[model samples]
Target: MSNTFPPVDGTWRNHYLLMRHGHSQANQEGRIISSPALGLTGFGLSPRGCTQLDTLLADWRWARPQRILHSDFLRTAETAERVAAHFDLTLTLEPRLRERHFGEFEGQSDDRYAEVWARDAKDPTHRQGGVEAVSEVAARMRAVIDELERHYHDETILLVSHGDPLQILLTALEGRELSLHREREPLAPASITSL
Candidate 1:
């Protein structure tokens, strides 16, 4: 993976924007909600999140997205919907963009994420607490881009997802060690990063 824009070798046919979903109810509650059973339907954005999207769209400075693809999770779906509505684009659900599964930590305090990430720094493949491995998350996240590259061209595509998966994807795209993903700057809720 090359960090340079346009990929330096013409590998990417589409401009990509990775946007993390806005602050969620789960975020306000400070709980881990990575299980599909919970994430798919519940924990949608908070009032602040809606305001964030409204403010962001009112400003609308990034490259206009031609397509919007997002995780089916409620928070992400809601986030994508806001952007799609703003740009008059439709949304396509992409399950691969779902939040990194937190396994046994599901429904626990969000503070437990630090423990999992610390383990990730030591062993990217370790599945402590049955959490999805960092390397696995990176691979799946990369596959999303690879699949998009195969079918799209000259289009700015918006990918709305959760924080950890996006961070892992960005780290992988930079050709960096997966174990160091947490060392990179954290992606703020409702923020967009171009790839």
Candidate 2:
């Protein structure tokens, strides 16, 4: 957070394009699918999701990426594949980019997210009901950027991940308290946030 990342090549010149995966079956069904097991096999892109990606790529307005990294979850993987194929870049599967684990809430209605967030608002590190701690997610997300900066410079890199993980990462990058994560604007499916 707060640009604390060590300078790379004498400056933080790299740009990271943070992309949320397009709407998935979970989005269509209004369910939460955060488990890596469930995400890997089910909850892939919905038909609308495919169209969203197609439209986005047809008129992409952001910096073209030199490298693509994405969570191994099916939805994110498919999203990254679409972009990578269009840009003629290889894809790297990064588990650290996986969605936040919702534990007992997996496959539940999306509304249940409110309950977790309510608790998160009070304690960012809470892991009740087996949920992953918010701080841990922030750390792994930060680690991805740290790793990228250490190896690359002056390049645009794309990272495809789920909504919550990306949001948490952004909040951390902004130097905001994790408890305030829910206060940020919700990320639209297939939307991009650059850093």
Candidate 3:
């Protein structure tokens, strides 16, 4: 593993920007909505999330994105749309960027995430409570980049996803142990990290 931004591997072809979806209805309600059955349709951005996106677009500090790829989840889709509209670009729905599925914790109190993270620190592969394993999340998230590398080049791409998936992806890209993903700085709603 390399400590480089694009990974020392020759696979990277485009600049990457990782953006977590804006604060969502689920965040406002303090619930976990990881399942596609719910996330693909409901749990879109909250009023605060809309404000966050509006502010972020107004500031627009990072490189303008030539392409925008995002999770199909409603929250992420809405977030990507704002950026796409701001930049006058189109969006590509990337299911691989979806939230880390929390299985038994779906629709549960958001506080339950702490329990899963505690277990993730012990074993990245553990599926305790039926939540997606840290390694699995990292793999799928990386696969999104891998596929992008195969098809795009010399472009600034924005990847809009959920908190845990983006965290796991960044930790993997940084060549760190997946079990330590939670140790990375938390990604605020509508915040972007260059990769």
Candidate 4:
């Protein structure tokens, strides 16, 4: 809720829950979609996605959350809404948790999506105008978490977002090398992981 930057390695009084958005059109068609793009509205939670959400909530074994934060992207927003409703919490949109900007790659073929990421793997800092550089995405994700820390220091925050940005954030926390950025695997829809 607070926009201020948190101290580096702030108090770990609260648990941060990271979850990937449910099944989406882009995901089904293997396209690299951005958060602001069309076709993402309500197209986020497919029938199977809804099933996954039900299963996840029914089987949730993670820590109980105090607040829910997620990207405005349809899939994430929808997913967060479902989970929040299950927990009787409000869904809050946080743009920093949005999907990576695919740049020239939005709503394209699968092969093309692969090509851009391959290039990004070779040079993580290259900004191809439309696409967000890995470094930039990672930095903003850190900013989002840090800001949460400063404001919700002792409050558990549930963050629902896309795959790439989530991977970037986890990699940053693990202190892994940047060159292995693209190698991070995707997170399952409705799956919850702690940070």
**Clashing pairs in model 1, backbone N/Cα/C closer than 3 A:** none
Q: Poorest 10 consecutive residues of model 1 by lDDT?
A: 1-10
Q: Please write out the lDDT profile of model 1 over residues 135-188, one tens digit for every residue.
A: 999888888888888898899999999999998988887778999999988988
Q: What lDDT does the true structure give each of the candidates?
A: 0.90, 0.89, 0.90, 0.76
**How does residue 165 of candidate 1 score in lDDT?**
97
lDDT of model number 2: 0.89
lDDT of 3 by residue, 20-111 (tens): 99999999999999999999999999999999999989988888899999999999999999899989998899999999999999999999
How does model 1 score by TM-score? 0.95
Tell me which residue pairs clash in candidate 2: none
> Which residue window of length 10 is worst by lDDT in model 3?
1-10
* Candidates sorted by lDDT, best first: 3, 1, 2, 4
Report the candidate with higher TM-score, 2 versus 3: 3
lDDT of 4 by residue, 1-195 (tens): 111122345546567888888777666777666738563564577777888888888988777899998988888888998888988998788988888888777777656757767777788888775688888888999888777776875777889988788877777776775546667665777767786
Backbone clashes in each candidate structure, one number apiece? 0, 0, 0, 2
lDDT of 4: 0.76
**Which has the higher lDDT value, candidate number 3 or candidate number 4?**
3
